[model samples]
Target: MLLTKVVALSLSFASVWAAPSPPPQSSEVLEVENAFTASKTAPKFKSLKASAAIEVYWHVVSKNSSVAGGNILDSQIAAQITILNEAYSTTGLSFSLAGVDRVVNATWFNKVTDGTREQTEMKRALRKGGAYDLNVYSSGFVEDPRRLLGYATWPWDYAANPQNDGVVIHSGTVPGGDNAPYNLGHTLTHEAGHWVGLLHTFQGGCNGAGDQVADTPPEARPAFGCEVGRDTCTADRLPDPVHNFMDYSDDSCMTEFTAGQAARLTAAIATYRTQ
Candidate 1:
């Protein structure tokens, strides 16, 4: 889930946190997301009847032994799955780690930005399982001047681009890691939301059909830090959802997904990911 604007934050560790580039929000993508909103009819995908268990294939792409270079430990990866399960507890979707593979490649580790040749090659070589299985690549985006945290592909894009259907995260953002404010493992949670079928909480920016969810109030922009009671869209009755995982808020600031979001997740999983 890439944001439109790049937010440059100077942290105590002197690490700069910049937003990732935007995913393609074309009409087809919008239609796929909005389809759940239009009708409550269950999708043809069979595995999404009540609850769906997604198999996660973890791929660690590193330059060397350094964790900063993307060689994250198995414990950190397990901690991330725990965080994701807690965050998505109410969504009726759960993730199980199917396998973990580590690839030591300096070129792939440093150059795996969104839509780049390096990213394509890396995913094609490392991606595992079918559309239902989640392939998570922990890699470095050092080549990008903005230092993107992570990005994900939509479920609708899987048919045409099966190899690209997965999530790429900055290895430093895992739990007990160096990237502060984002190290609590919420980056994967946020990107996983996109990987399923969620638009940003601030998708339409106070315009029509914001995030296409009925429960979440319209948000004018992404919230950076924990700005409690901050209301950007004054016309709306509720304050900004800075605590939502889908926003640009820090890991500590993110909390829960709304009921509408849960419904959307179920619908999206049924509609796209299921067989």
Candidate 2:
């Protein structure tokens, strides 16, 4: 979840929007993911097949014809899908745009903040498909002071919060849009990481099993810019994974997910989402 927007001194498009705060990871969520990780070979468990197909249901919520007001083009949406596919290419996961619905609603377009009543109402009315399906909503966050780029519900949270089990992103964050440093369509990639039950690479900092992934080095905090060779938690002698999609790095900075992350994502989908 995006917490607050940091304004940088540089006026360039890439520097206008700073990295967002890492999303909160609860103990219960960690326990669930750990259990799945441990039970990969259990009798009831099965590995997600290669190139597991994930259907996407896109809901475009807009105030009017103005693209600045949340109305985005179909070409932008298609480019976003391409970006998502390329980012997760090595994770044995594939995303296909199954459906797209565009709505011109003032309230839902401008006022749907995460965990708010408006968000709940909008999702309940628009959410489609099952646990395996990904529902994406593109809207404006004018009502949110945080200016969130995006937010998502974990796969395990789907049962309890069926209506909220999806991802919501700022409309301008799509490709060729205004929210630079994030306009490359990587905000969805980060939130979708949360959707698949992957915690931030910086989660738990340098203390516990950071992100429950061994390959990604524990980061003391989220990396802002393209800080090459940045080592935050040097105790492990490993540099922070500023290039991982799970970090709060800029779109240009984020590149790939670790192999452990891919394995975890496979297990998560097999355990929680396949049902």
Candidate 3:
């Protein structure tokens, strides 16, 4: 979710943290696989009646932050949780804050990775929850925006990179914080959508498997700002879903997850996150 005046690919995935990519390339949908089939632990998702609130633990990292103490306030984090819950309130799923931990490291805070060196070290040392609780890490910057704003590990990626099994976001995207247009805290809402199993509404750009979900219309690219009544994929009968939480729309523009996404979340949780 590289949210400038316009939306850029979440991040360049060659190095670390795969989110939405640039215009020509695919979005995070390219990097994320269907973890529902990749899970080796929990059984396949079947029952829809199951409802459980997921626990999320926070790890705040800072050293050279532009902010005062480089640490986000507990109240801010709580408010972010409230926003997350609000977005997913209709789904049979939800998240509760487990706790918050902080680390003041300059080197780790500066560099994020994809199981290479420094990023792996950060995750190995700081990561907490196993397959259940969501471990969220906040840092100074993700190092590249021609690619990303935040990135999350797919539920299946946890087994291979257990330590890196969470989402990393900038400290300013929290509500009433910095990061305008995106200051509304929907960045977490979007990335967490990926953490579960959702994909960008414009996933395949009107081509191949679009986002792996039905009902969400396709777009040739990520939406910029809140362009309502805009349809990128005109050939398809359905209009582009800029208002979808998974798309790169502005925080204020993004609102809902399709029923397909809800079902996918249920299955994804059952298959990969059930603990």
The TM-scores of all predictions, comma-separated, are: 0.88, 0.88, 0.83
Question: What is the model-wide C-alpha lDDT for candidate 1?
Answer: 0.76
lDDT of 3 by residue, 1-275 (tens): 52211222233221122234543244444444432455423333344345556789998887753454357888889999999989987666678899998888877776763434767788888888788788888775645443345767666565665766788776777787677777788888887876776666765678877777777887887777888888777887767888988777788988898778887887777777767
Q: How far is 168's C-alpha from truth in model 3 (Å)?
A: 0.4
The CA lDDT of each predicted structure is: 0.76, 0.76, 0.69
Which tens-of-lDDT digit does each residue in 1-275 have in candidate 1?
A: 34222221010001123553333244533565455456444543333535557989999999998887789999999999999989988777789899999999999988887767998899889898898999999988888777678877766667777887888888989999788788999988988887777777876678777777888877877788898898888897789999998888889999989988887777777667864
Q: For all the candidates, what are their Cα RMSDs to the real structure? A: 5.5, 5.9, 4.7
Error of 1 at 270 (Å): 0.6
Off by over 4 Å in 2: 1-30, 34-52
lDDT of 2 by residue, 1-275 (tens): 33212221011001112445433444644666566667553222234544357999999999997788788999999999999999988777879999899899989887886667888888988999999999999998887776678877776666666777888888988999898878999888887887886777876778888678899999888788788899989899988898998877789988999888887787777767874
Model 3: CA > 4 A from native = 2-50, 64-69, 113-116, 145-147
The C-alpha local distance difference test score for the whole of candidate 2 amounts to 0.76
